[model samples]
Target: MAAFFKAVNAKIRSNPALSYLCSTHFWGPASNFGIPIAAVMDAQKSPELISGQMTFALTIYSATFMRYALAVTPKNYLLFLCHFINEGSQLTQGYRYLQWHHWGGREKAGVHGAVEEAKEKAAAVGDKIKEVASK
Candidate 1:
């Protein structure tokens, strides 16, 4: 099991997008699982507090996921689609928490905003490449 995970980690590390995706896939669910358990065990701790922390964590995960999604190519469309659906769900949930509950801080806005920025930059670069190729 250890060797299997080690090999997977090495493969993921070879690509920046894969590294981010794998890290989130591994740690996001792990932390999410523990957050509820910890909250339940600690009566004195507020559930809202736990939820707020989770939203913040999810925001980071969503941003990293966005970067990974943007880096994926058509050759990996199926794999990208699978991760997109999974990560997009998390992104939506995190955004809802911020919009409705206002539990998370402005950091969510900044990180979430990066997704749009990355998209714009990628489009511009693609356009430039096309223009150069045409010339």
Candidate 2:
């Protein structure tokens, strides 16, 4: 069993790509990408669901790690990319939260406003039909 494992390791080491694939440098950032992916997906959800504290925390976290990714020995670009995406997503989420909570976006999108808007559109359409019939 040890011999088989050793042979596989030797094969992996023989290829530059395969060796990099087996390294933590590749897998660490690859797995960390899920956070950014999830953050991007969350952007589609209602801003009311966003937590201000958590969004702020993640923003700071991503920014810090982005700097670390650049400072590291190998300069992990994959990690930097992951954190860059996460930072953008978190900033977007934070903006949405502020807009919904403090900037009147929620009021404009509320159920009452939607119903009033629909009624106005229906009335306008009815008036247009009446005008066409009268002509």
Worst 10 residues of 1 by lDDT: 39-48
Candidate 1's C-alpha runs over 4 A off are: 1-50, 69-75, 103-135
| Winning model by TM-score | 2
Candidate 2 residues 1-135, lDDT tens each? 999999999999999999989998899999999999999999999888999999999999999999999999989899999999999999999999999988998888885588789999999999999999999
Question: Cα RMSD (Å) per model?
Answer: 20.9, 7.3
Instruction: Report the number of clashing residue pairs per model.
Output: 0, 0
Alpha carbon lDDT of residue 116, candidate 1? Answer: 80
Clashing pairs for model 1 are none
lDDT of 1 by residue, 1-135 (tens): 999999988988999887766665545545544433433344343332335466567546645654665575523333344444445555555455555446554344475478689999999999999999999
Position 38, candidate 2: lDDT: 99
Write down the TM-score of every candidate. 0.28, 0.76
RMSD (CA, angstroms), candidate 1:
20.9
* Candidate 2: residue pairs that collide: none
lDDT of 2 at 97: 95
